[model samples]
Every structure is written in structure tokens, then in C-alpha cells.
Target: MKVKRSLIAEIKNMILQSREQAIRAVDNTRVLMYWNIGKRIFEEEQAGKERADYGSFLIRSLSEALQPEFGSGFSVRQLERYRQFFRTFPIASALRTQFSWTHYKLLLSIDNEAKREYYILEAVKSNWTARQLERQINSQLYERLLLSNDKESVLAVARGEKVPSNATEIIKDPTVLEFLGLKQKPAYYERDLEAELISHLNDFLLELGHGFSFVARQRRIHLDGDEFFVDLVCYNRLLQSFVLFEIKTHKLTHQDLGQLQMYVNYYDRFEKQEFENPTIGVLLCADKNDAVVKISLPENNRSIVASKYQLYLPTEDQLLKELKSELDKLDDIN
Candidate 1:
């Protein structure tokens, strides 16, 4: 009787596992079907000699014909998107199984091929949901990468050929805090900002970029009868190091860097494991003194970074100016 019961249980488990596998296979097939459909529609539309006029009429006619028979999926806009879908991704094998048709729609909206490719690779590699992919693309992930890394390195990383080494590699400076629901140009204290960040910690971490895991906030350490408090402590799994943060509402000073360095030294000596890299420190200030920052750190310094933070996302004009300045510097080096 016992032997028979065990056999029944095993059989039921096998059946359940088989059912899940079947479901996944069907889902994958559905994705392939859509890709093929998009490809067919695109080719037909292109063969229309009038091009623009034919393309518009094709979508409108297809929507009218298919909507009644095929139902809600074939709207005029969706038909147009399908035409674009075929145009953008002529190769069906490259369509990611994890993403839905909605994901491809967002990618299609990106005008630049290079930028679209970057977002697609990142979204697939990260296993981001459609909404997350849309948000990151809309948030200008490619633009941020261009600002932070050299063009070659940025392309390499986007193509998944290279992995980022440090926080600065992935994290954007002047982090856009508008998503935190904080007032723009409101009278707020540093402590108030800290409180709001803690309240919206998950959003802050996303804005901080990949690999950051929260450790402690307002962490205190005791040494030789003196106590020091670091504003935020985080661990970057990719970098394999502890990231110490010191937040200042005002302009950064050399002393702020010194204080952060002390925290990093303490973490390196006592807190971090032998296998991990030395701790890194970040000075998150409302303003920064570039001359002081250049003089305060050694030329080869890798473990400390200082970045300014803004209450709001910068305008396109500001972003363009910053980009031009950075490009100028790179040109000078070359």
C-alpha cells in the first residue's frame, strides 16, 4: 500500500511539471507567431509602390477587415505598429522570448537604431518587464550612459561585451529626484531630503542604478571614544564593495571628502570581508567645488566619488550643454 501511494505522488508531480512546460512552449509559440505576422505585414506594405499612401491605407483597411474577425488586437494603430515591427526586426530569431508585443512597440518608438539596440539588450539581460523597459527608455538610459562612460566603453557595455567596474560606471550623477514626489525648489532641509529618500527607498535605489542594495541609513561607528555617523551605507553586488555615502545639503568641502574617506577606511579594515574589494565612498552634495574635488583626491583614486544631486530632472538644454562639455574634454584628450 505504501509503495503504491508513493508512485501516485510521483506521477502527479510529473504531470504538473509537464503541464508547466507545455504552457511555456505554447507561450513561446505565440510570440513566434506574432513575429511572423509582423514580418509578413511589413513585407506586403513595402511592396506597395506608393509607399506612404499605401502604408496608411493598408493599416486602415487591415484594421477594418481584421477587427471584426480577429477582434481587439488588430486596431489601426496596432496594425501600423505591426508594420513598423516588421521593418525594425526583420530577423525573427532575434525576438526575445521574454518580451511581449508591447515591449517591441516601445523599442520601435526609439528613432535611433543604436539607442534602440542598447535598450533592447539591457531590457532582455535584466529580464525587465515591459513597463520597466518603457520607463528606463523614457528616462533616457542611453543618454545617461553616454554621459558617464567613454563612447567605446559605453557601446561595449551596452552590447554586453563588458561589465561595469564601479558605482560611477552605472550610477548617474545629478540623480533625478523628481520621482520621489518631493517639491521642486521647495524649502527642505538635508535631513528632510534624507527622510523622504528613506520613505521612498526603492525608487531612490532604482534612480541610483544597478547593483545597489541598501545596508544601513544613518549608520554610526565608534572609534577611540569618538563617534561618526555615515548618512547611508550600501553594497554594490557587481562592484563587490561597500559604498559609503555622506550627504550634504550645501556645497561639498574637502573636509566632507576626508570624513567619508575615514568611513571607507574603517569599513575596509573592520567591516568588509577579505574577498571583497575595499569600500568606496560617495559625497552626495547639493553643490560641488570641481577645483577642490580635483585637488583633494589622488590621480589614481578609484574608491571615492563625489556627485551633485538635483531636486528635479534637468531640462534638455542643460543635458545638451553637459554632453557638449564632456565631448569637448574627450576631443581634447584625443
Candidate 2:
């Protein structure tokens, strides 16, 4: 007798679920085992306080014995990592089952306690794989956020302790577009940059920070027989407003800022509802002069912002130097 298709589908689903659950159970067990191994090594070292200077010899001896019995994973270097892991995370109860041993291993490489904690929280919140976590750390997402906000606020947002109220809180300057796969040399046009960005819309949204969804491209506006086009239009759910992006391949000017301001005003007057907040306008350019931006916008400006965009990711040293420069400027102002 043949089984019904519905029953077969149900059986397949049950098998898939069971397999997933079993995999999760095995991974959790493996993490716990590593933690226990680290804890044991730590306790044994503590008991031999007088011979602590022989820690290397101790690890080597242990590795020899364990390797012969259980195989090659317990090398001397691996034992050293286990010992350091225990030192880094002393409380076993604090370990999160959601993350695998690889995640913890990657996080252990980060020296800053606060920064490491922030990455852990963000990784969980975003449901990022280990690779994603590594990329974010390498990209200095934490430091970039700190560029626009205080350290406390950035950490608070990552930990879900606070929510951002304005676009500036989440939006980053010098937005990275390395994922677009565009050539840096030969000089690309504004239309080419826009096309590349649209082609990689998902990456663009991710780089744009949270809560943004694409709405329109080259959005057209008509006024008294005159027609104009905005490069990109998006909506920010958290801010409850439309966001207009004007891309420029060259340095930003007063004219660019003025055009964006006009677009923002147009959306605020016509497209926005009474319940929605004011529309935000972002001028994405290859370069921007702070003095020009300040002179173009009103002293109390909050809606329009000018930000530079990079076709490639800056090196770690480059980003750190820029960060230090910004901090020094803030200090001088204070």
C-alpha cells in the first residue's frame, strides 16, 4: 500500500526537525566539554601554584597522554588555548548555548572586554554566523558606531539596553561599499555607482545600518513642468520616515546639500503623514568639506546630513588614525 503524500511530507518534516535538534544537542555538548576541560586545567594549575613556572611542561605532558588515548585535538597549543579560555571566561554558568565553541574561540582573541562583550551581544541579536561576527569585528563596527555616539550609548544599543531615536545615532559616515565590487581606479560616474549599489541592494541596506528598506530608485519629482530625480529612496521603519539618498561621484558642494534639503522638504510636505517624523536626506559623496556642510545647513539642522562613501574598506591602521584624529578634535572643542 502506498502512503499519502501529506503523510510523507509530514514524516520528512519530522525527520528534518529531529536531525536539526540532534545537531544542536551535539554542539552544545561539545562546547560544554571544552569549557569543562578548560576549567579542569585551570584548577589543576591553581593546585600546583608553587610549580606554576612549569606550566608549559605541564601542558606538553598532558597533551602527550591525551593525544595517545583520545587522538590529535589535544595538542600542546590546543591545551594552552583551553587554559586561556578558562581564564577569560571563569564562570561556566555564563556560557551561552546559542554560540558554538568556534564562536567563543574567535571572541577570545579580542582583548578588550567591553568590545568583546558588545560583539557577543550583537552577534546573538543579529543571529550572525561565526564568519559574520569575524567580518564585523574586522570592520570595526563597534568603533564606527562610537564615531557618531558615546561609548556608553553604543554599548547600550548593542546590548538592547537602549534604542536609537534619530538617524544620526545609527547612520555611519564614510559608509563602506566594498561589497559592491566596483573598480577604484579609472573613475566611475555617479550613475555607475548608483547602479552598483542597486545591484547589491542587500549589502547596501546592511551597510546603511538597521531599519532601512529600499523603496524606489531614481525617484522622479515633477513641479510646474520641471522634473528632477533622486538617486535612491528608502524608508526607515524605526524613524517612521522616508529617507532620500543623493549620490555624487565627486566632492560635495553647497549646491548638492541644497538639492538634498529641497528633496527632504518636498517629502516632508507631500509624502509624509501627520504621524510620521520628518524625512531625512543623506548626501553620499566621494568627499565632503565639513566647513561647506556647516555653512550650507541651518545652525539647528537635524534632517539633512552629508556623508562620504568609500569604494573599499580602510585598513585597520587607517581607521584607527582617523578615530584618534576625531577624538582629538573633540577634546580641543571641549
Candidate 3:
């Protein structure tokens, strides 16, 4: 965790001194080596910069020279990757010490410049490790966050310049539950899904976006001597409201949305303070029709939502299709 580092050459000598510390030392050495390699390669490439054949020739010669001593990590392809890393990140001084090469490597895959910058800044702001950053990328967090909020609003929320007033601003529809360790099946009960969410509260919070704090499970209420149990309760600091979640393992229906809406109304009427916003309700179901969900609520409704929960992360094609569909809807509205 310490940025205090040694020369990469010192590894060969220290490898013999401490067998136990070798792995940790090598990890630190590897991170430093990535920046050093990238900076050197970029400098060399710029000095003799030319067309493809020349660039290829330079990298290949460098690889052959370093491969004899450093192994496959210095192969031509990897060397090129390091060079690109330096090009993308530019200055090593501006880099986060906590970010390992793994994080930068992931960032390189993102093509959109604003999207890439968002991930980089968010990773540092949230103190995400490489693995956590990868998960967020894989989950397409940036795009999902934009579903309820605009690009400027998303950045504003990140920068503390705005407060989100809607459920979709912070809640992801079709939320991924790969961490719940559940197999996709028709027979899983609502209780089973709720249990998995409770067991994996931390991962669920990440999936739920930001400012979510778990409040209660199977929350009880009374209406005209009829008892109703809410599946889960949470509070969002940014929204300044209580969020009620209803788990539905089956395909979502208007009735399901209506039921969750009642819970939101209950919380707002009985539990919320005058300064707090209205309560939000999320019907986390396995499947839903967007049209049905839309028509089930008031014309200006922003609190009640029926969000389908996925058992696994969506593939790139699926995410693209979803984005295109959203854009089409926006075009229609405009």
C-alpha cells in the first residue's frame, strides 16, 4: 500500500534475501515498471516517430532486447500496450498511487473520452480497488447512471453540485446480481431473492448506486388492521428519502407496481419528515414490460419504479441494444 519503492533491478538481489516478501515486492515493482516502460517507450517512439513499419520495427527491436532478460512481459504486444497506457494517462505524477496497472489497463479499453475520464475520477473519488473498478465497468455503471440523470447531472452529482430527486437517478434498472450466487430459475421465491440481497448487502449497495444505507428487512406496517410487510427498506442520503424495495421473482405486473407504490405512500405519510423528500419505491422483479411500468403510474411519477433484476452481468451487445433503445425513446420525446 505504501508508494515507497525500490529500483526494478533491486528485485533480483532482494529475491534471494526474503522469500516471504518477494511477492509483495514484485507487485510494487510491477506497477512502477509499467510507468517506467511506458514513459521510455513513448519517448523513444516520438524521437523516431514514423509510419507503421517504423513504429513496429522500433517496438520489435526493443522487445528482442528486453525479452532476453525480462521474459514475456516485455513482448512487442505488451510493450505497445504500455506505450498506449502512457499516451492515455500521459503524466505519471498525475496518476493515483493506489491505482495498479490493472486499473489503467481497463481504462484503456474504454473508447469514449468523457466516459473514460468519468471512470478514472470516480474510481479515485470512491477509493475503488482494481477489481471493484473492473466490476463497475463490466456492469456498465456509467451508462446505467446516465439512465435517470443527464451527462451534466451525473458529473454534477459526482462533483457535489446537484442533488438527485428521482429513483432512477440512483437506482439501476435490470440490476446485476452475479454476486448473489444464484442460478437463473423460475422457481426461486421472493423470500429467496430477498435473502440473497440481505446476505450480500455490500455488493447490493454497490449495485444500488450511491448513498444507500440498509434500514430494515420485512418491515411491518398496519392499515385498517390489515398488516403488510415490506421486503426491504433503505435510505438514500443524496435523495433525502426512505426507499422501499419489494422483491418479485416472477414477471412484474401493474399490481406489483401498485403495491410498491402503496408502500412509498405509507412511508411518506407516516415516516417522512416535512423537510425530507417523498419516499421512493422499487419493485425489483425478474422481468418487466417498460410500457406496462410506464402506464401503471401517474403521468409525472418519479418515485415508484419497477426495475427488473438480472441474475448475471449483461454482455456488450445487450448493453448497446439497451442504449440504442433509450436513445430512440429520447428522440421520440423530443
Residue-pair clashes per prediction, in order, are 0, 0, 0
Model 3: per-residue Cα lDDT over 1-334, one tens digit each: 6544566558756776687366546665676688788888778777777565667888899999999998998999899998888788787678766677788889999988878888887788677878889999998888877665578877777766777768877788678889898887766888978998999999898778768899999999999999999999999988999999999988889889888888888999999999999999998888889899888889999888777788888887887788788888899999
Per-residue lDDT of candidate 2, residues 95-187 (tens digit): 887887889889999999988988888888777778777767766777777777788887887777887677677778768888887778756
**Rank order (by TM-score, best first):** 2, 3, 1
Question: Per-residue lDDT tens digits of candidate 1, residues 80-182?
Answer: 6666777788878777877776777788899888878878877776677788786676566677667877767766776778777766677676666766777
Considering only N, C-alpha and C atoms within 3 Å, which residue pairs clash in candidate 2? none
Worst 10 residues of 2 by lDDT: 132-141
Better of 1 and 2 by lDDT: 2
- TM-scores, each model vs. reference: 0.83, 0.89, 0.87
Candidate 3 versus the native: TM-score? 0.87
Best of the two (1, 2) by TM-score: 2
The number of the candidate with the highest TM-score is 2
List candidate 2 segments past 4 Å from native: 1-18, 68-72
* Per-residue lDDT of 161 in model 1: 84
Backbone steric clashes in candidate 3, count: 0
